[model samples]
Target: MKQQIKHQYAGQYSQLSTKDFNYIKDHLSWELLAAKKCAHYAQESQDPQLATLINQIGLMHQRHYNTLLQYVNPQSVQD
Candidate 1:
C-alpha cells in the first residue's frame, strides 16, 4: 500500500528551499509582466467595453502577483 503525505498550512517562517524560491520568483516576474502588458493594452484600447474587460484582466494578474509576494514574505503583509 502507498502512503499519502498530508499537507499543512505554512506560517511566516516556513522554510522555502532555494529551488522553490527560484520557481516562485520566476512566476512572480511573469505575472507582473503580464499585468503591465494587459494594463497598457487596456489604456491603448479605444472600445470602452474591451478596455474595461482588459482592465479587469490586468487587475486579476496584479492580485495574483500581490498574493505570491505575500506568500514569499508573509510577515510583511498586515491584512
Candidate 2:
C-alpha cells in the first residue's frame, strides 16, 4: 500500500508533502494579500458602513491566515 496525505493539514502535527507545502505557501500569500487589500479599501472608503463591512471581511481573511499558519511556519519553507 502507498501512503497518502488525507488532508491539506489539520495543524502542524501532520506530515506535509512538497505539493502540500506549495499549496499552503501560495494560499497563505493569497490570503494575506486579500487581507491587505480589504484593509486598504476599508480605510479608503467614504461610507462608514462600507468601511465597517470591509473591515469585517479583512478580519475574516486575517483569521484564515492565522488558521492556515498552523499548518507550517513560513520561515520553515525554503525555495
Q: Write the per-residue lDDT of candidate 2 for residues 1-79, one digit (tens) a residue.
A: 4344544343444666667777888999999999999999999999999999999999999888887775566443333
- Model 1 misplaced regions, further than 4 Å: 1-12, 75-79
**TM-score list, all predictions:** 0.78, 0.75
Worst 10 residues of 1 by lDDT: 3-12
lDDT of 1 by residue, 1-79 (tens): 3333222226324556676777888999999999999999999999999999999999999899888877876555566
Error of 1 at 9 (Å): 8.9
Best of the candidates, lDDT = 1
> Which portions of model 2 show Cα errors greater than 4 Å?
1-12, 74-79
